[model samples]
Target chain A: MIENVTLDISGERFQVFYRLRCEAQDVEAFARHICVEQTIEFPAELIGDDDIRRHVMGQVVSLAPLDDHSWRVVISYAVEITGFSLTQTMNVIFGNVSLMPGVRVDRLEFPDSFLSRFKGPRFGLQGLRDLVGEKHQQLYCSALKPMGLSADQLAQQAYQLALGEFHFIKDDHGLADQPFAPFRERVSRCVEQVAKANQQTGGSSRYVVSLNSPAEQIVEDAIWAKEQGVGGLLVPPGIVGFDMMRRLADDDRIGLPILCHPSHLGSYVASPDNGLSFYALFGQLARLAGADVSIYPNFGGRFSFTRDQCLEIVKGCTDPMAILKPIVASPGGGMNFSNVQDMVDAYGKDIMFLIGGALHKGDATVPENCRAFKAQVAALLRR
Target chain B: MIENVTLDISGERFQVFYRLRCEAQDVEAFARHICVEQTIEFPAELIGDDDIRRHVMGQVVSLAPLDDHSWRVVISYAVEITGFSLTQTMNVIFGNVSLMPGVRVDRLEFPDSFLSRFKGPRFGLQGLRDLVGEKHQQLYCSALKPMGLSADQLAQQAYQLALGEFHFIKDDHGLADQPFAPFRERVSRCVEQVAKANQQTGGSSRYVVSLNSPAEQIVEDAIWAKEQGVGGLLVPPGIVGFDMMRRLADDDRIGLPILCHPSHLGSYVASPDNGLSFYALFGQLARLAGADVSIYPNFGGRFSFTRDQCLEIVKGCTDPMAILKPIVASPGGGMNFSNVQDMVDAYGKDIMFLIGGALHKGDATVPENCRAFKAQVAALLRR
Candidate 1:
């Protein structure tokens, strides 16, 4: 009976390896609980019903004790159970079991058929490179910040950032449809200003406006950004569900590149032993959700992300997959001129250098600061 | 310059306290970084611009050392910044800074005007009691689980649970639209059986179906469930989103009481110092998102939630707010019939005791097991 559910690697079954930390006596119960919690939530007697068990039951591939307190529980589920639906797939992965503590989703291995169901990335690393017309060098990105500026003033900053030759200018994550600077007005003005600056400077800089709105209005805003010819759209998938990003990428009506922001998502990666790995969260999940660029905090910044964590995020973005195109791992948060070369040395040419306040420091004008920031990247790449 | 942006409690200013763990030298910079990261993204020179600083800047309230490595940093922003949108409110609370590690949201205090902008809960504790036609006892709830069962089998279980005079019968959180028991068919069948059993037993048992679907289809499913005349709906806001729950609670067309499931939400409360408090995640946030019954893992259960944490969640559910009504704090994970009295003693009459496997255990039939569970609760309350 136990041999009946033997996992066929070529078959349409998704394997999810969960690191379940529990006592030895509790290990068996924990493993069984996860099987029931992740798949069927009924009596074990039902598993005796062969038809029912095969359809809805999850089989524990193997369970071994990692330590006295923790056990590595590997479980596999039939892909048909997920219905090839992204939301359902997520539900299948961490639905009820995510409620239980010490059960971390260590790794997720999807069958080719399962991965094929998702439209990975509309514009990935190379596509983004082609869109910006920067094929060889690392990309440059900046943020339009300080929430109270009127649409005109914010546009002026966007124009300045573009003039400095930054490839992408994003709205700070905090910029929503506030009373001071409304969404439509700010996005329109900034988009226009970025266009004008690109025309003047002969550059292909993009203004990626924030489209973090209510679910009903999010699509409308995305379409508006496309109509206004925004370079890209920044979506905080953590606030808006990840599936929303997939929908955006799949919708041909608004087929613009997406920059996934990591807002309200720190808890998942804060604890190393629980939740998701940095590579999985920022890299794999972002790419799966159709992010052209996954933005995270860079190391040696005010943030707590270390160099190793940042490297994992990079691997998750660029690692080979079935058909999912690689995406850029854009790291920001406290980046400056002083460490741009170090960042370049660490990430090489595949990454995007996201500098914020460091570009504006010292006595140079905004455009001069931008030029200098661009020059720093160019010099490092040339070397 | 600081006086220009005075903290006006009457003028809709929301205060957020963050526990920033950092070295002594980094505290001031961390405080300033959060202010800029939250509001204005431009340089400090831009803050010097009276117009920009007056409207868009967040003011640092106070900073005090918590320990050798942590500091309590209080920051306030003008309510106008959030636009009173739940999505935006969450962004304002923990947006770009969520990428930063060790900055945990300790507390959130909102002005009445700000809190009044969004609808809280449709049915609180009293309303739910009124809905279920129960007046003077702690309510009892069970799950129709072990996912491999067919729709007819699940309906039979629902029928048996209702016949036993249980107050509520909910689909286990794992029951999505699987082929074994599709959403529409399973929900329809379960609803019919519960209604049939209620009529046969002269009872008012409600079957709360799980409506966790893709974003586009979730609303459609909710409407379908409502059209079928289901008692209540269980939504995993963590999988969907907390704001999406708010949207559902606000929509009049799908005006059904929501049972917010804590699936994929453990990471937020798993760590003591890093993420959200249990009360914040399960209680206050759940109530704010319109969860009529906020379900969490009970203390001394198979799950890791502590007794103190469970008590805090109860307070979060029933504690006084401006207009947000008190809701039922439903505790479930690892709960059994044997510990029903202990649960009652711990949580009292205002709580909803959610027992699952224990209800189906012993020599009794499924219906007989349910009756024994009801008897135990009755015995405890009658004492």
Candidate 2:
């Protein structure tokens, strides 16, 4: 994903490929606008220091017009500028520039120095595969939904799904600390139920709760949930903010495979020519911030991620970065039982098929649906 | 801003007016999609409980077609669905719904029960005006910029600006805990300089620093900064998140005016037909999340908030919302001395004139520029 130009520049730097929407004549100026806007944020002429100008500011390393409406402008900034903080890294990447039009982050090239600062994916693709003992086989995931369900109802669904051998049973993002099914009660009952089902079936099914608690309690709850035997976390980077998700992922004690949910992040990828490229957000950012399974809307849903965009997200997840491991691309929005072959053909086996609402369809019950999904996918894997 | 229709709904409900872009014939279905999608993400037929349908689920209160492509659809949900927390409110408002296209959050209606749950702005418009003893005067604010400055250099700039009687001086959002000028050093020196200036000129120029730290350290840093004598907090909700900002504002001990910076929030407003309305993000969300001073790009800046959009933000800041206090509209990006009267004409006097880099221009020194800007604005105020 990062075909970075070997820039003859000083010190450690990170490269950001910006797709600048500007005319042919305006490329250099527009690229310069990014250089200043992202760094110093002051008029270049007014910044009197030489080192600040040369070392601290962003440098436009490459610029090429992509047709008439846009140009690919790659800019490099000093790694120290970020202070190695995840939020500040975000502030440098898209911060103030997000407010302006005609620019979207295309790709990022991070040096190991910058990349090492983040604990990218504690339990990546291989870890997830090993957890389910489906190293080479396709993995299946589903959400417990129709949210006003009590803890007992959700726990029953979790037990049924886990018993039927779902690799991952996650809470619907809507099921937060709502009064109907409080986070503590739901996680407690479901984790217990999942353990019971895994014991009975000898299946390595994991119960993942949405760590969608308020900022104050999230970290504590993550620790508590891990202690309470919850297998993983359904971290909604959008609702909780990506940095908070990163914090949860990076913490050593609460190590868990994060299923990165694309909740509020739709804004970042909604605009075609602004915010960030789909790969940059769902793929690169998610993997870089520590999503073992980066969940996004599949192509066919009312949620509109094109087939090409979905492919790009897959590419983003699997792209080789120094020590950052490859992650599972969990495509969810409108997955159905019949489309398993199509999805497998498109994304290959490096995906955790997230069949949500569709799993509740047909005359089959939840357990039957899960077993049926697994049977069909297992058959396909055998072939 | 909330024009609620008196509905015979059974619970304490909050309303969200969704702008649905769809074919006229498909309005009801698209509206129904929002009702299910926002709350119960499962199929309506599958939800077996009656109370969940009648109480917990989102109801389509009204739907009216807007032209050929868009419809204004209003939906109400149980207030308890949010759990009365800031982040959960955001989740319920724009969680998974944000991922889907053809719908944008137009306006929000909150009942007194829900609105009272939030602390709102600790120091709203009157509190900020009271900070400078300028209740009747149009307030002026500025940002310290060109980031790579040493603590001493930034402190000197802060001293000059405050000495010249600018009501507030804030750190540039770019000025985080970068090695060049660490957060603690910068905040300490700037706050000291501003205090010295206040002593010399009998002015109340508060030094505000950006509370843009990593999630783990943000709250601690906020409390530390306040205890270290920093007058106000510039919270980039896009970085620290709105909920985190609300937490800071709501905390009784570290009570400081919050200057909400729209750093990474541009994506939410960039797409014309997706994400959220300008007022919803900058205005309503800012106020509801407890931003005492909501800063945004003024029109005529390269930053693309139009004149109309800027006006809407001002309306959002000043709009009456139950017991929630109104906030000051800080019009920023590309503000120049010559445009003071023009900005005054448009946004009126309740504005915090956020003059950034332009203050460094012309024959005048920084202190001289500040004095001259105040003089001109004071004359306009007198007139």
Candidate 3:
């Protein structure tokens, strides 16, 4: 019989403990469910006569309350996994069987052995700040746009944004393998243009190109972007699996910071009191999954996230708990220069302010427009 | 200039049409947003100024309301594709920047020329019914366990259920690659044991295994499972990418009915007047993606979905649509033998009644238990 199993749920580096109680005789089976089952609710097909025969076999034994709102559950089950490898253990914890409802993960104890293997964040907050040469300053960020532009046109926009001394300039998530501006050509042109602007301005304006290829194409794209001398890669982990991001983060050859984009992930945490909380999903999950910068929608934008939710997301990104790495919270969507002061006030100096169309809403020359937006943001942040 | 783009929204499928007015200089960019971006409502970094500019360019020129509460919006845009192959057309529509936010897919016009290349579903409604030989009758479905059952143990239970002649025996969503009954071992053993029972009883009870492997492992798992003679594969398209299911459905070599599981998809349609409705997500989208059967939590379950939502899902599944396919609505969670008659009454004769733990809540052996469950369900249908 297995008495207990341990889990590490990362929330801003703080290791929260969860204990699962297993009433079943098979401890390994119980442990597997604890790791992967999203919730404790069971579907009708899973329970058989024998399952009901030992209905009380899998039940919570004890759950210790953590300092945070989270609790650690401990379960006891008669299952065994003496020779299971880490990968096997991970599969057991998160395998297909754990998708049953009402299967609460009771005991979540993080042993130093398990915690040691997980490299939380390779380049966290300070590392990113150092890379960009910004000390305790709010970073200005913008995105290159609409899919129809040629590589040169997109690069020109990157140059304009870089000339404003913007801290970060990422490709629109839509700018992947399109023939209009193929990824390689776009990355090369944008990186070169940004480099030129950075040389003239003596500022560190990193160009992050979109790496929106599928799994097979992901690493290839990352390696290609790195060869193109791009500062970072913008990845939509939601569309691509999180494991791909983890793999990219682990690769030293792909040494660029990853800007995590939230697309198609609204379904994961859109419901109230169900699925994961926004802070947990965009902030904690993104950071633990190795995102250096996590971008979510700003409140009063076209999206429905509230101001409180946005603030909580920012807190989840920066709050120091365990050895969790801090990530930059980049908020955009319907954001404008007029609200720079408000955004700065709300998110503090260590944030990334992302302004989109409002930067080029009117017919203004790209460089001058970017400079005006930059000046407004700088003046607001100085307050 | 592109005159109009049409979308097939599924209910009253042949009658359903969405026309968009595309005045945008970048018609493909506008179409991409309308199809994918606006639907998911991604954050600003993912969807940038260019996307919004193009979207603003395309207006709803004319909306022709169709039956079944569906409407078609017409949009005229610059640059229509001519003399392009299907792949080229897809590339033009979504290639470079498919993952961006707020990029609504203004149009998804599937011409038979392109649709002919796709296999759609190999074992759609009639094929699956033919395999089971249970004509004009609602099917009885149940899950294997919550979690923690070993391969031998799961096989024994599966054998007993097979003896009782369950139309469908599926893995609980939680039963992924867990250690207790590793995926390959569990699946192999369960399929063999069930096959043996089928041989004995001259019954056609089928086993549907959950193929929740990561993106890279998905195709391999599907192929492997099919080779192993598993009757069907359960796919939670939401957790995995939606395209994976489409690929599986298109695979003629693996002619298995794909059971769509709504595990982490609550966030997409959980809210009213916000995201897609339940019918749209579970019904139209799932069907369009090639789900022969769609599973959702029944009204009285622990989950918050209402009777109306369940009914809508069924309507979406069975209503006259393009290449009308029968999608068995398997409602579980807090459902049991006691409510078989009521369930049959509500959902009618074309439903798949799924009863989980309650079937095993008594001291009856697996065969006897399943027998009693089948008897009750049969009696209800007769009544």
Candidate 4:
């Protein structure tokens, strides 16, 4: 599958853009330190092998001062060292250096060799749109909430939401295999109920179950969810490994679109000067890992993502990568019906507006609330 | 079997100690917000069901002002909500609330019902000490380095390190299935060579391979590594899910002491007011997820762990948790031979000195350097 791998000393390399928030004098040194620390982690003088020194060692290609207090540096690592796996690529990019402070990964650029390695997002924006067979420009999604609800109660909730004709109805990230409503029981009941509602309304509503478990069990659960005629899967890539999600995305047997949730991953994007950018973590990496849809906290939400950061997240998701499909960005932390127009106005049509709690704040019943949400979204798209 | 689970209005609950870094006036309100956001995530007025509100909702047990600008809050959730799973436990504790800016998880306390769910560590401190069969107070571990080395070259290095009689020699976390040294070839060769060296020296030197891959492959690789006569496993719980490592530690067939490396988990501990404390993230959570030894950056290391923070991490690893055995703390990240005495004096006997690059920096050959390291440790411990 890897057609053209540059094996020479100047072999094609994947580039990582890092924003070093340090003293002006220490910028180059900081960039050089990342180069050394990322690869060999040993004194360059000690590395006798020239091949490893030149190829395996991370190469710093560009360094520019961002301002008085910060510098932007671009570092490159050999394509061969990544071994064409998401885990290794992440290791080469972040790995031990993630422990360091005042460094933020801005973005990443991969060569053809590295890009060809992953089958990112099996059902991205177009595929998902095709699946839905909907004419609306903006798709809407709602989450089933209150974790202690029994299978029947949650399924009934799902039926009400699906009847609203939202493109996707997903389980809350917290809804795992709990004793109150076990995974199999909850997933099957929700799938069946959603399907029955869809059949009645002649709408193609898909129910997504959260697959947050150990690796082996997640795969098993994914297969089971697919067998139950479930349309999609919600996986927190931070909880389960990204590559694990990639495996699920690439697996044809259970080829459901994966929706990535920001669970334990907030820390990575929270620190502006310490960790990775929201664009890189949520958008690029999620797509590379085969997530058809990625979710993050929207602006004016309970969470602390600014409008600019949220917009950047949308850019990362729908931006053109080499051959990878642009994934749909679903922004929902404290989303409500009142802000629905504002969200769509900012993110435009390709996005999925995930309105969770606001659906409950409606004056009408739950199913009636769904119909009202449909009218608002349809009206917004027409505008 | 769950012995006694209180199932009333005031039932047994697992406690999450959080530090809210906000204004004094917003202390209780902030704590209350976490209680609401962590569970249900919906407004109380919207939830008509009394049972769901009373039983499943997160309870704010204690709230106190820590300083003029911060507050200490202890929130508890029903044991039934956790569903006796690490994935869900993490979700309930952090989950959606992880996106909050001013909150930090200070510590955690589990009830009997929650504690009984996990079989902590199969091989804790004593179990690992038995495996080594050495009389040394502080165990020594070294990492095989400089990526892009062939499997034969790495195996030779492993053999040399084993001949040095270090307690354990581990593959660097970056060493995945690269073309230079495929995982199987590197693991099998290193295991064989280390065993041969141990046979010659009459030492019980263990070769720990880094299993940083997808879930299914990691388990399969672990079983195969065990069959190849590997003595231990090194897992990055951050890259691979924490529960995945727990599954390996609990698996009886491939029973080996698990060493946890902090790879992509730095941001969680880096920010003072945004994410989790070093103690809670590295110490308590790692042990709860079944790590026999947890590795983090030392105080004076290349990384930015303060001396106090490092000590807290140690306490977290070895402190008493219900029925869970105390795991050894392996403090690494730019550790050298010069700091061995200081490290031991600070950490006492129940620690492992993971000296990697320093082993190569010695005047003598690596094998001679190993013996010198042994003499230094033995002499220091006798004092």
Please list the residue runs of candidate 4 whose C-alpha ends up more than 4 Å from where it truly belongs after superposition.
A1-10, B1-10
- Over B21-59, each residue of candidate 4 has an lDDT whose tens digit, in order, gives 888777878888888888777676666546667778888
TM-score of 3: 0.74
Docking class of 1: medium
Q: What overall lDDT goes with each candidate model?
A: 0.81, 0.85, 0.62, 0.84
Candidate 1 per-residue lDDT over residues B39-135, each given as its tens digit: 7665666346464465456778899999999999988887888867888878877776766667777677777777788689998999889988889
On a 0 to 100 scale, what is the lDDT of residue A347 in model 3?
80
TM match of model 4 to true structure: 0.96
Q: List the residue pairs that clash in candidate 2.
A: A121-A290
Clashing pairs in 4: A121-A290
Residue B3 in candidate 2, Cα distance off native in Å:
36
**Model 1: residue A56 alpha-carbon error in angstroms:** 3.2
* Model 2 chain B weakest lDDT span, ten residues long: B1-10
Cα lDDT, model 1, residue A367: 84
Question: What would the TM-scores of all predictions be?
Answer: 0.93, 0.96, 0.74, 0.96
Q: Sort the candidates on lDDT, descending order.
A: 2, 4, 1, 3
Cα lDDT of model 1 by residue, A1-383, tens digit: 11123222223678888888878888878787777777766556634646446546777889998888878888888887785677778888877666677788776788777788888999898898899999888898888866666777779889989998889998887888977679999999999999999999999999998878887688888988899989888988888888888888888888899999988888888776678878778988889889999999889986789999899999989887678999999998888888887798889998888877776667787789988877877887787
By the lDDT metric, which is better: model 2 or model 4? 2
